[model samples]
Target: MSFQGEQYPGVKAPAAETDGFRLNHTMLRIKDPQAALDFYSRVFGMQVLRRLDFEEMQFSLYFLAKLEAGDEVPEDKARRSVWTFSQKGLLELTHNWGTEDQADFAYHDGNAEPQGFGHICFSVPDLDAAEAWFDANEVEFIKRSDQGKMPDVVFVKDVDGYWIEVVEAARMADKGD
Candidate 1:
């Protein structure tokens, strides 16, 4: 009875003209850029790809990603901006200028009572190892794999209280054709 096999009635197929379109990144508003950047780099091993600052607008955008071995990242900022947008699965953290200075500043983490955005996820090669690493890093856990019906998935909260689902890639269901 799972919806996985269902065709999602009334949903039309996307046009071939949209073939080149891609999901560049998901943006999350963070109070502190440095804290978020450090967390992503230290825990998720993401590197900042490009940073855009809008001074008059009083905000900044930072794009981050885990580049593979063969990926060629340009040294030029302009080229890097284009290259960053071309890749998929990048995480963008937006910071409104003075929010970090406000001691009580907080963003609605989507999982609260009026839920909207769910979560971002990462596929780790080893679930057990990831759990251990998270423990060592003192990552806050919403759900441990062994504690839930789903035994291979783990949910942890980031510095800003955004839930991030972690899973073992090998256990993911194949997209059957």
Candidate 2:
């Protein structure tokens, strides 16, 4: 898997030296905060870790993550903010005000022409069960687990049509590829 393209020479940052560096979160713009929050919570079992509201700016940021069974979120605001920042694999949902009321408003889902951002993924315990649940809940599937080149994975859409890839974590581990 190689491609020929123009290359530029530049000094590389010392990524190896950054001891505490980690990918903290990925942001997705949503038109309706409630709808997006509901979809994520219901489908992915994610909980809101923290929320930042900017009234003057007319936008709110919701940080969500799938916490483990025994994990607890800090109750203190400052401590919770720090704890949230330190955690990896967070999803930040940004909702701009007034977009929900605009019937024709929508955010570019990054899957059509001029595509850049692709999709976010989740590893489930059971692929078959998850697919069945999605179908029962009336969730739209872009690709089913039994279809596509990667037959073991499924892709579903959110309220805003953002693609989410779901796969069986145990099966993926067994593949060992």
Candidate 3:
């Protein structure tokens, strides 16, 4: 399939290579664990599914997920660990010790001059409500939904300056038109 005069090769991957494979999570380096936790939990309703601390290494990993209604997290650590790995679309936050104490500390949000990573996205049930909540909470926005060419979408920043794109799930049905 091609769009906008660009040809897209119809590529196929070996079934064996993709059969049992799933994307586990995407990791983001955070300077302050508490701050990052607060932002993700409060803004996106993500819960910390599991926390792994490497005290000897002076770092920690926090796995977060947005649990669905009536879904319960496994109580057993082993089961929870397995479940966490089995689930798709998880966010992992890594915190290196002592970073919070530094007066001038910030993570490379991957959207600077030589941008590498772009942004994480959240599909909300109501984009307008989400934007309003963000505004009321004084969340920093890189681009407001109404200001963009795609008026129904929003881009906001987290405590560590990572960009998060917010869009209404209903918009997906519209195909951006």
Candidate whose lDDT is highest:
1
* Model 3: per-residue Cα lDDT over 88-110, one tens digit each: 99999999999999989998889
Model 3 whole-model lDDT (C-alpha atoms): 0.89
User: Candidate 3 versus the native: TM-score?
Assistant: 0.90
Instruction: Report lDDT (Cα) of residue 22, candidate 3.
Output: 83
Residue-level lDDT of model 2, residues 1-113, one tens digit each, is 26535456874544758867899999999999989999999988999999999999999999999999887788998899999999999999999989999999999899988
Q: Which pairs, if any, clash in model 1? A: none
- TM-scores for every predicted model: 0.92, 0.88, 0.90
Ten-residue segment with the worst summed lDDT in candidate 3?
Answer: 1-10
Instruction: Indicate the residue-level lDDT of 55 in model 1.
Output: 96
The segments of candidate 3 whose C-alpha lies over 4 angstroms from its true place after superposition are 1-7, 174-177
TM-score pick, better of 1 and 2? 1
Cα lDDT over the full model 2: 0.91
The residue-level lDDT of candidate 3 at 110 comes to: 93
Which ten residues in a row are the worst by lDDT in model 2?
1-10
